[model samples]
Target: MTTWRPDVLGDGYEQLELPLGTDPDGEGEISATLVRYQPPSTDLPDRAVLYVHGFTDYFFQQHLAEHFAARGYRFFALDLRKCGRSRAPGHTPHFVTDLSHYDAELDEALRVVREEVGGGVLLAAHSTGGLVLPLWLDRLRRRPGGVAAAGIVGLVLNSPWFDLQGPSYLRNVGTAAVDIVGRLRPRALIPLPKTEAYGRSLQCDGWRYDLDWKPLTGFPVRFGWLRAVRRGQAVLHRGLDIGVPSLILRSGASRFAPRYDASVDTVDAVLDVRQIARWAGCLGNRTTIVPIDGARHDVFLSTPGPLAEAFRELDLWLEWLDGADEADTSGSRTEADDSDDSDDSATVSVLHRLTGEHA
Candidate 1:
């Protein structure tokens, strides 16, 4: 456990907490952090984006926020309970028995974004965050007038964990064994080594980022967390209808051996990229899969060459969504203009009225 300093993010962001009351099992209070990235203007943004970070990671991507801002979208990121900025001294980093536990934080965050920014939010999540959001959205869809079916307009997943990244036997039997161990010793640290090559490939070794936020050596993998992740992966395998346009991005290939070589720079050594492409169709009807050559796990965090390519693809996609001539799949030309008078204003006003007392 390294002592973390609060210099991980840029200057304009505020750390806000949401109380989740006592844990259902009577453990303690559960809370989450909301990191806001307000645009440099008073006029509300026509679009909003909510970013969720991956395991062993936090909302440190200021560059990403700038990208969204440049395109006229207000961006926000969440550091879920027990992860990054939200992690308390006694709590385990990234530990949760059920993925559903994130709903409380996510629901509140969405409400805040919808109220303050007054628009449909595009969800952008990476890795484990990718896994968590879709399932959360699915659950939200079941409830009447839930956040998932309401404010979210689309989803953008970067290397989503659609399934476990090992042999079938290991995914099944090994996961079961790990689950048993997790039940017995939830907090016990287990070995889940991260390769140095991947770290180097991302330029996050030391110079690029503060070590406290994203440790080069990575964080411990607890049994409880692994079990929870395995459970979530199983659900993703069954498929989800998020009921929105989705963009799935991944490296072209995967390399998973001990040797740290230049190949690590080109492919996703952390996860099975093929699996990302295969199950991508399961997301929804308007899903688009784009494979970037020589990209890392978190595509935006890739090296300069691959990173630029990823951004190019992202810009093109956003442009297309904005009703550009090149790729207008939505077939709605006035969508962006129509957003000015969107029904979201009424929703935002109501949410503001409901949450005004808390503010």
Candidate 2:
């Protein structure tokens, strides 16, 4: 991998530009940015993480990197083509007619991580990224033995978008309309109910990210993009056997409001938590679903009380994975932990009470 120069994150982070050929959207000469976090010490032993951001998002979570780096894992994040740092001039920001097209960058990024980081990498993603990685992992399991397939030993999802939010009939009918419109006019904009509640809670007067990229209300929803997301969600609903141990964290409650309220401070003001809890089981066996009491749409970006809880839960899950990996190596792993599964033998655990020292 060629590390030409410094990335947007600067300092310890550097960017590797992957030439992905032509963009199907006709944006021309496509490339994706792989932001690598250089560990302070070259002696840090065998562990790494690859973080994928959601729609209209990029890997800007320094806290997340700190969490993993402190635990001795080299960290990297992908700015998927046409999003964040990878968005070139004349390219439609975060526009993709097919989610499967992302497999190219995702595969390349994983390969680079495995080669550069030199260890089993944990694939962690948030929101729409949560949906994207699971689908990719499911495909990875079916691959004929490759680095991208073998490198990702585990997955940690932050509030995955399993199903569409809003009313049932609307989700059904609206998606149908979106499918038709997307096929006809791929770039057509969907008329959506604008809600700034989640934005107010997250951005809070530019407390965090670059508003131009992330935005206070988020990027506009495109017909083809939503259709692609729905197609992925449908595949998820049909159940995917994503072969590796996974952890999903979400807000236990969701409160959607037109105007800002105190409730938005603690709840998931974006997607429905019930839908996440309902379809999380479809991600195959050996999945742990955690519901943070006061987490926002993104669990890691939650407030102090619940964000700490989310991190603690993540740490606990990481420990469980180490044990599970040891068991697998010793040939003591069970059928539920199989690499390829055709049945709904998933063990979805919800940790309500803090256990052991975690309490």
Strongest candidate by lDDT: 2
Misplaced by over 4 Å in model 2 are 146-149, 325-359
Model 1 lDDT tens row, 179-273: 89988887788887665666666664222665565776677888877888888777776866676666777776788756567777778877887
Note the Cα lDDT for every prediction shown.
0.72, 0.79
Model 1 bad stretches (over 4 Å)? 1-8, 24-27, 146-149, 204-207, 257-260, 324-359
Per residue, candidate 2 scores C-alpha lDDT tens digits across 96-188 of 998999999998888787777677898899999999998988888787873244766888999888888878999899889999999999898
| Residue 272 Cα positional deviation in candidate 2, in Å, after optimal superposition | 0.3
lDDT for 226 in candidate 1 is 82
Collision pairs in model 1:
none
Q: Candidate 2 — worst ten consecutive residues by lDDT sum?
A: 335-344
Q: Report, for all candidates in order, the number of backbone clashes.
A: 0, 1
